[model samples]
Target: MIIRYLGDSELAQVRRRRWRKVFYVIDDDLMRLDDDRSVPEDYRQRLLAFRQKRLPDILDLADVIVAPNERILEGYPSKKGERLDPCYVTVCDDLRHFDDYQTIRILFPGSRSHLNDLAFLQEGLLRLSAAHTELEIVTYMGANAPVRLKGMEQIQHRKPLPWAAFQKEQQRERFHICLMPTVATPFNQARSINKLFDCAAVGAVGVFSRGGPTDGVIADGVDGLLVDHDVMAWEKAVGFLIDDMARAKTMAQACLDKAGLCGNPVRVRDFWRKQLDI
Candidate 1:
């Protein structure tokens, strides 16, 4: 039986209803449960209390629990003889293909929630634009993106494309690269598979930070180039590719071939089939 916490995405709800034929665990918001006190009066109190009392029992009956990340698994203890059945799927969508543009396409927008570091992207794009007229840096800026770079000709701000469309665009480019320059932080260290797979699947060589989850996906100077989180290093890597098309194509092909083994759904499915004896 497939079960999910209520109030999740409509797509998930529809899937659960259609395939599993099960009831969703309708629970009131429990974000306050970690606090020391009970919630104040609310219409959801009954649902909240019921969930608090019966969640463990519900989990015990579940054949498999899909947790978004490892942190969620911490709360659910394994029964004495029963192994915990949990699986994780990265939220990022698979890559698609779009049209080809002549200029080098560098997509390096900072983390979605952090608006402060946009200046790095703007400055980096501006410097690259000045150095090479053939470069086109496309970034989707939020409503709060800095106004200082608004008038720059080469820096075009389009409406943020959906992930699928963005992946398609990455595929179409003759040369595309994803730059992730993370300021050292615990949060930055835990970035998921989105950036690595997105670029690699579409044959774009990644210029990623030398550490973090990216390190697991990228091989230094092999599938893609890895560099310290420094602006000069970023410029050199991107510049070398822009200047040497043959090397860039070779690296891009290597990334695409390697990504097929690492992130391809068919390969991943086979891996689990062997491990789980499916």
Candidate 2:
């Protein structure tokens, strides 16, 4: 089984080779293709001008089309012959081992590209560290992390490690949490649910913005906490968990239990197999 990404220019390459199965990750509505095309002159008004003859051509070539999340799947064109399904995987390193520290650790900073927006998380961390003198806040340093974070300077910063080491380290901690604050935009609205799965798998409490696909998975005050995009809210939430160890532990256990049922890789794979009819 060879997996290939079918993009605009790369769709033709799949035909050159033969494979048992091919998967394409579809992310847009076929009806909205005109909005994406480069054809000038009243493109919005000329919606009918751009015939969708090429859509079937693309779909016919694909053996299986995978949508990463429910949002992506919802946006996909549903037709009689089309076979679209959610077959996305959370590609984070498996953290099934390690049992050491009893301190809380937090992982924020969405991606390397938007480190500036993530600076607030570092600020929150500083405030957290100050209130709890004995707390150990481990910050995973991404390859593109900024030089410094206020109040986190004293907090231990570990270089990005191999998947095995990283997962081992993550599981050793008492709790793990992810804080992601996405700026309001159509593009940001398309965020993936993998972060929730990733944090849940390791029994880490997940903290995220109420926007995007997070709402579908995280139930505030239930499985995880949802915060407004304000730094104060983030700080308060983090502090609450850090101060209340028992509640944090319970939430972590709940996350682990839920993740085992819903985000299990084997279960996810079986879902894909059923969807793809393989």
Candidate 3:
């Protein structure tokens, strides 16, 4: 069996090959490209030509179809296609959770493209920062971060690092809470639970936007906090964690426990075997 992780050109080369082929669809390129207003004006045409046009053709040749998230699977053409039971995969690694840290650290580890989503909470974050001097706001997106947080004393904006150095960054400085604020756009809806997994890896309890990728996993107020994309709600959720250290620790541990189930390599291997009928 041959597996292609969103490699349209590679899959195209082996279209009529004898071996079984699988295509993993993580993003709906058509939806993204079509929503030109939401997407950057500069990247629209290029993305449409390549991702929108070239990618979907590979789906027709695939013997099996796999998607990391359910929403991604639902976007596929249903008229005439072989769509298998979707396998939700998590990109998690074995990293020690430093939950016993003294100070409260809040992280927003997305790229500059996520600036649009974070704009909603900029005002709330400013208020939260001013009220709580002990809270530390950390972000890799320096200039892309909320304008009010740029020069704040409590907030620290570090330069973005490569994927390989992510664990190292986590090791050097542990965070207590990770914030993920997403809008209800097609692109945002199809996002994976990557941020949640990242937080669980480093023993950070995540506060995610409800109806986003973390829906199936996070049990609000238990493992993680799932709230609406409102300013006050985000502020309140962060405040709750800050005020109650014991609860925060419990939730962080719970999140790690949930992460263990999703991130297990053995389980993933078994799932692949079953999917491939090996």
Candidate 4:
């Protein structure tokens, strides 16, 4: 399994390694970097170069390309003409109880790459916060979190964590709701709802963008909520959860139940075993 963004020397070393099967995994939306202003120019240039050049070589060498969804596979077509199951695969069991809760907790659980998507929800978040004094918003963006929003008494920001640490933290802490809002760009369009899995892993009700991958999958107003690009819509979805804590708690458990069944690691392992024919 080769996952890192390696330099030429490292790439050559990877090629020289002896292995029965090679896998390349892409857990992000790597499309239309030039149009995404949030990405720094130099870094964007480097990413684009890698996407155009090194990606082909890596795909050619990889026995299978494991990705979060079909859109990514379509965006970066492989010679095999197929993509593996996303394999985000799992759920959290010991979920947080909502009874006796004083404050409504909401969190934006994403890395710097998701800042643009999170920003799309800023106005709505502000409006929602204004309406409810008991609401507490936690963000993982740290110093990079939106300045205006971070200054609010209800908003608290934490520094981004390493991948392993983030997963552990997801298990440790609990929030009532998780937010995923995205603007319509090729970059955002090609992304997956790994956020949906994250929502389940944290055992929180998810509020997703209507046109994104989570749209059809979420079963809105049941296990989760879906909002359009409208700021009022975003505010409304969250407001629904705040107004009805019992349903909100039910939805969170339903979301986790769905994840455990749909994203079972055992099922994933079996699928891969069959795919590998071993």
- Give the TM-scores of the predictions, in the order they appear: 0.62, 0.65, 0.80, 0.89
lDDT of 3 by residue, 1-278 (tens): 33433355666567646665554434443544475345444545665676556556655555454655555566565522333322223322332434344557888877555666677778888898888877788878766566766888888888877766865666555577888887777767766666776777566788899988888789999989999978899999999988887788788888877777666667667776776678
Where does the lowest 10-residue lDDT sum fall in candidate 1?
Answer: 80-89
Q: Which candidate, 1 or 2, has the higher lDDT? A: 2
Candidate 1 local lDDT, 174-255, one digit each (tens)? 3366666655443344335456655664456777777644666677777788877677777888887777756666666677
lDDT tens readout by residue for model 2, 131-178 = 777555555555445555633544655565665676565455434565
Cα shift from native, residue 169, model 2 (Å): 5.7
* Candidate 3: pairs in clash: none
Considering TM-score, which of the candidate structures 2 and 4 is the better prediction for this target? 4
Error of 2 at 191 (Å): 1.9
Superposed on all Cα atoms, model 2 deviates from the true structure by an RMSD in Å of 7.6
Q: Report residue 90 deviation for candidate 3 (angstroms).
A: 10
| lDDT for 132 (candidate 1) | 88
Worst 10 residues of 3 by lDDT: 79-88
C-alpha lDDT of all candidate models, in order: 0.53, 0.55, 0.68, 0.76
Quick one: ranking by TM-score, best first? 4, 3, 2, 1
Show where candidate 2 strays beyond 4 Å. 1-13, 18-22, 26-64, 70-102, 113-117, 147-151, 160-176
Better of 2 and 3 by lDDT: 3
Best by TM-score: 4
